[model samples]
Target: MFWVLLLLLAWAVAGAACTRLCLAAARAAAVGDTGAGIGSGRDLTLYEAAFLSGGPRRVADVTLVAMARQRRLLLAHTGWATVVDPRGRDEMERSVIGAIGPEGQSPIAPVRAAAATADAVRGIADRLVRAGLAVPDGAGTTIADAVRQVRLAVPVVAGLGAVALLMPAPAEMPRHLIAMWFALPLTLTLSCLAMARFEVHPYSRWASPAGQRLLGALPRHTDGAADDRTYLTCVAVRGIRAVGEPDLRAAFAHRERYLGQDDGR
Candidate 1:
């Protein structure tokens, strides 16, 4: 009977954890910004598209990659970025050039950090959010939190199973019955996880549903002058590593290393 009480307690804890995850996921989904409409007919500029698909940092990355590809900026494997043209063709390019400062050159790490936080990037994000093409910060946080909660289900179930197995058994007590009882909580946790993956995993981290649809509708280009735009789009969608140039890839990798260090602290 004592062992039964212990098992019930374990089950109760698992049930409570599963309940919390389910409720969190429900709240996240319920409050998710469905956006203005499926087709608001709003066109996305390169920077706006980047923000919708990958957020502000991606907008900065696309701007840097585009400038580097155009020979306006030089990205070295040593993590230095030097201005070659000193002239920016657009607002985003101008922001990146400005972030490099009066020296006309700077480490890619600091340049990327500054570019991401630039006023132009903030403006792009704001526009995208207002147009319903980008996820609002609060909603994104909610979905992220729910995903994290669901991820805990596995460990919670494992801990409960361990507790059940460690309980002392007396004569006439069915060990198999205890194992079967443990299955109940495990089932609950697994069900909640499956439901979340099915329901919430379709949405991208940065873009809302309308934003995703717009991203899908963006035109592809293969012409010579359009190649830079194509590459920038690819970087905005698939990330910096999609850039084929070894030196350029290294430049972004160096930036990531510093960002990782900052996150660790």
Candidate 2:
């Protein structure tokens, strides 16, 4: 029957996607296993924490915020960044300055884009991966992308099933039977998504389970903290929205709207 062929196609799509996701998850778990005792009692640097919490772009955000706070860089509410101090205190700050260009002034958006992909950020990512605290590039389903694929598959299977039901079905086989056949793939996708939710919800795009544990152990700071270190730490782990200063937060908020960046969740 034509419906039978469609059902087979549905199963193929669901099986391939779900299998890939499961394999990725398994590989990620294996990485976690091998990372045992790594980074134990070792504190995360602001850059490391930024990468683990939100990847390279976040690292750029942290560096910009830190420099701006220290008055080494000027972040205008109009999304422009001006270099105040020619000398960078660290590699990260230097990267941002370089991204701002030889003129020492640039739009915050382009600078952020450039700085995020800079070698400094890559180095941080590499170190985190080596330490088993972050996922490697193209880690397949081990990253949040895999879960997203599975999520997409669910709706695809449902739509395909609906299409198949509208097609001609053998009288003896029955439309109900055809629908049941389609349900298998849908069920498979749903089951996988459910498992991922329960087992590894809010799947980190950057950190592995071992890394996540360390991140969880980091001290949480409230908005009232006066120390720049504590304040920057919160921004590093939590993002720009965590900035307590209205001027500082407004600066980032303006940048986000201009560049379509997230609120640093």
Candidate 3:
């Protein structure tokens, strides 16, 4: 039937898209695993951990949180960062301080953005990629794009099937047969999507499989001020909101909000 031809075309397109996406993801995962040396004695640094657990922004966040806790910088809940000490204790600290500029005070948002793009952060990312602890930028982008394509195609497939069933049928062509025919492709697409999610979702973001394993092995401290640095380290690797200090959490939240507005500009 004429309607059947249209439904077949839709099915072909959806099937091809799903197949391509799944194959690409599988290839990327395979390459990543080969590049990532299993049981290698290499240890993850704090900066690398931050990058793996989050990304460039997380590295900047860790640096800022460290300086704030050390009294080298002041992170106000008002969404501003102020310099308490002009001297930076390390390269990362120096980068953050430099991003804050000579005014000694600026909105935390811009500072975060600057720090994320700083040379120091790039160096860390470069080293991580070289060591195969982080995903290659291109590979990560490909995986993300593929995932998005599959997601968009799902609705298209469903719509096509619905339209095929609603179309006027000839006396000889049964609606039940049409429904069954459309269901085959729809089921195939859904199955492929589920498989891709199960296989790729874990390694879809910043860290490679090896890096994720290391992150899982990181310790979580429940003690008080004595482990404040450790706690902050956890926050950096996980997220700012994990920090229990209300004021500190507010500082990070304000920075995020300010950054969102600044980005819109």
Candidate 4:
């Protein structure tokens, strides 16, 4: 039982660690932006990581509504005016869709407008944190299941490091203890890199797909409860530099920044 638990823990820690490194790297590569349009039928190419991690990966299809295509269709129909979007109405607010387009579907409209798409794209990133897919910052279990899994893995990771030190290690660098010491750190570092790499490509693909499918799947409204948890966790993790420290400041500050950038702010 002890050994069994240990192995499971090791696997969990490895999984959690991998999850963090990937998300962090993806966020960094994206310059703090988690682009939109994931799981939308319009763009399916960004499914790389979705495919790689399969269903177990938190950021993929699970949080998205299966009938999400209909939602976009509604946005398009109700606001066909502003919906005359080159990339569809992705950037425009759904409420104002008509005024923005009504009929400007002039074939000459530019195919993509990144700035216009900013609101929708950022909204998705903020929401993912809400759904418990991303880390919650500091120590709280933002994604309870994932966090618990990661916590379990921590000891396992430590155990592996300890065990590896006492065992015969590869001779490529050196033999015995010294090799194990160097090898452990290097392995950990590479694992971190591998995890981060996982966060980038697929999400970005969602933001830039042809049908704008990735951009389309985002819920028009942000998730408030999830947003609160995300804000508290991020501030706790970010410490003094946290955007908003308390309720009032957090409410206004976060709202002004990203969709739910507020919370504990």
Reference-based TM-score of each model: 0.80, 0.90, 0.85, 0.23
Between candidates 1 and 4, the one scoring higher on lDDT is: 1
Question: How would you encode candidate 3's per-residue C-alpha lDDT over 16-75 as one tens digit per residue?
Answer: 778777766765666557757742467777788888777888888888888888888999
Worst 10 residues of 1 by lDDT: 30-39
For residues 55-167, what per-residue lDDT tens digits would candidate 4 score against the true structure? 11112121111112223222121112123223333322342233234563311111112222344434544444343232223422222233344445555566665554556
What overall lDDT goes with each candidate model?
A: 0.71, 0.82, 0.75, 0.33
TM-score of 4: 0.23
How many residue-pair clashes does candidate 2 contain?
A: 0
Best by TM-score: 2
Look at candidate 1 and tell me the lDDT of residue 231. 64
Q: Which candidate number has the best lDDT? A: 2
Worst 10 residues of 2 by lDDT: 256-265
Candidate 2 lDDT tens digits, 141-163: 56477888888888888888898
* Candidates sorted on lDDT, descending: 2, 3, 1, 4
Worst 10 residues of 4 by lDDT: 58-67
Runs with alpha carbons beyond 4 Å of true place in candidate 4: 1-159, 163-189, 192-198, 201-264
